[model samples]
Target: MTEAPAPATPAQGGEGLGDKGLSGKSLADHLREIEFDPRMIGMVAALAVIWLGFDGLSGGAFLTPRNLWNLLVQSASISVMACGMVLVIVTRNIDLSVGSMLGFVSMVVGLIQVRLLPELWGFEHPATWIVSLVAAVALGGVIGLLQGALIAWLAIPSFIVTLGGLLVWRGAAWWVTQGQTIAPMDSRFRPLGGGIEGAIGTSASWAIGWAICATIAVGSVVARRRRRRFGFSLRPLWADVAIAALGCGAVVATVMVANAYALPAGIARRLTEARGQVWPEGGLVIGHGLAVPVLLALAVGVAITFLATRLRFGRYVFAIGGNPEAAQLSGVNTRKVVMLVYGLMGALVGISACIATARLNAATNSAGALDELYVIAAAVIGGTSLAGGVGTIAGAMLGALVMQSLQSGMVLIGVDTPLQNIVVGLVLVIAVWLDGLYRKRLG
Candidate 1:
């Protein structure tokens, strides 16, 4: 029988191609690819430019250390929630209940501090602070577990379940507080969320935070190499090194900038008089440190990144997102995965509530109000796809920072809160639309 034309060789594969005479692939194709959503990157870049432009117009005061640290603390709650939201969204689901859950947790914790802790079933202990925290977190976890089970095992739509949770949790929160505010937590607890570590000029805690970020960055690079080796994939060493170094540099810059503001006026004068003599007994110190919350958030971020990037569970998460059917065929327990993701999100919200409560020094009935929108916006704006399957902790953090900066900067610039809300809402719509457009292009 007459044979068809012979198959083309790799060299001959490009013969019919125009100009470059190159194949479809290149050396870069074998490297670890860029993982961020394009829409996210664009939004982040735009927000960053706006932040810097505004700071410049404001005579550089907006970029001070105090302001930066404030920004980090404010962003932390949303960023943590966004990380978990990323997982939920990747599974093609949304958790509208997070805000109510947060509020519930906040109210529960506040009550523990104010009422529950003091009345311990009959007897009271002066050491109720620890008990209160544990109980608050446990309750949060339990709620999440129940909701996750309902969504995963019961096969109820996440929308309905979480919507129910939103209403239920809000009522529970109001019930717990009787529509009143709880305040004046223990001094010890305050420091955990609001206390500074180090002298006025140098926050040792912020330094530690940067150190943790560096460690995480290094660990990520090594883990990436190991993954490539195991997958039998080829990657250029230089690229990994470059990426790792860039990450470290960014962390250092953030920490440094957040601590680089002028020492408070009192500290400055003391340092001037001391002329660098032993900090002049509380003179403006170079090492006056940062708030404890900043460090706590950094530590949390590092741990989450490690879990998401370097673990088998994390791999399953991405696989399930990429294609649930394929992942199921490959032996992944899709139901369990979904349950675990929601549970994890619940735990994160619990922790976020603790931090927010501590920072506010009270859990008002309005705690976590409207926070869900901001948290979700941060994730989507940072590049988490609402349709599921792709996201990063770093991207979520960046997104949170961008959102917080915009809000804070707007207020600093005399923009009304109503206008700010309108702006953020518009940005959210634009981001989602852009994401949809990119998906269409890819399809």
Candidate 2:
């Protein structure tokens, strides 16, 4: 038949069909077609609702710059740990000891800085914070390594091993100085916890924001070029541009909000006096830009994202999580990767401990108490599957923010602590149930 009319070439028929299909799709279907994560969109929408609801309930106080800034700061330590938790959970492991590990590491850091280092380096020595930080991180890594070894090499279940570690580390924390609280951390170390003094100024924040925007734009171009070179599928040019624009817009908005929060007049005056500068007649409006702890948390998130997405180790971790037998048969060093993942988790806890201790200017056995619950809840809420091989650094960080927002919002509205715990428990259960449903749908 006239050679079947050349089968109505795909360009002639397929294009129209595709156009019709797209025209009939909903916004969500379009987003899915673009390969965007729907869970992320849901989380963002939920966060927005939470913020607006809390703001209304609190008479507009919750959305104020000061409260928002403090919320970011409060989320920092948990976010840092959640990044590590993503890796741990990805490989089908759990670390219940993170909170205890944090407590112990912080206690040791406090002891080193306040009691031991002062005897050797003297108080406020520049090296005190550095030495303490290094020691704490090392200790954390060692603890993690030991726990990982027991799980990987000895064939012990991770839950049992980490459970033991939880008790052991908590007791060790209490034994360190016999449950005494240490206070007034070194002057230099205090900035890590994030106070007015711990923030970068408005100019610096703007500079950083613009720099990040430039990086996002450049990265998008480079990625597109790479894909082209490989002859791989690519997103539409508009999609790429939109993604970069959204990222840059977020950075710009964050910087703007940070810069909008002016310091109290009394604090500004005292700060100026300390700097040997005269106070302005009407008082100065100094913006406490990005907080140090928040910056550190963001940096950690970036580094972990790169590690998980770009490195062979990260690939191995996911492979193991997806199918341990297959990964092992494929020549992956499953044991070593598992052990290393734990060690990395411990190191992150050390960083978190430093932030927490610095923020409170003290370390107590109770420091990081119940933190494990928060960390796990955050990772889970962020879309990390407890079953394995499903998580993202950015998602976990966002999850941490969501958890913090819930707690903060409740506290702002004067909810009782018990009620707060009940709310968090319910949220955790709901997140797990939702995750199960999402996974089932995907399957």
The candidate scoring highest on TM-score is: 2
Residue-level lDDT tens digits of model 2 in 1-443: 11222333545544545332323445555666666788898888889998999999999989988888999999999999999999999999999999999999999999999999899868999988788878888998899999999999998999999999899999999999899999889998988999977888899999999999999999999998998998877777888898899899989988888888898889879988999999989888999998999999999999999999999999999999999999999999999999999999999999999999999999999899889989999999999988899899999999999999999999999999999999989988987897788757644
Estimate the TM-score of every prediction: 0.82, 0.93
Model 1 alpha-carbon miss at residue 16, Å: 14
For model 2, name the residue pairs that clash.
Answer: none
Q: How accurate is candidate 2 locally (lDDT)?
A: 0.90
For residues 1-443, could you state the per-residue lDDT of candidate 1 as single tens digits? 01222334424455544322334533222321433244544665777797787698777868777677777778878888888888788877888898999999989888877776666553335466566667766777788888988998999999999999989998888998698999877555665465342223355646565675678577777777787778744334565666677667766776677566556666566666677554445445453355566666666676777778889888888888899899999999988988888888888888888878888888876788878888888888777887788877777777788888888888778789899999888877986787678657544
Please give the CA lDDT of all the candidate structures.
0.74, 0.90
Clashes of each: 12, 0
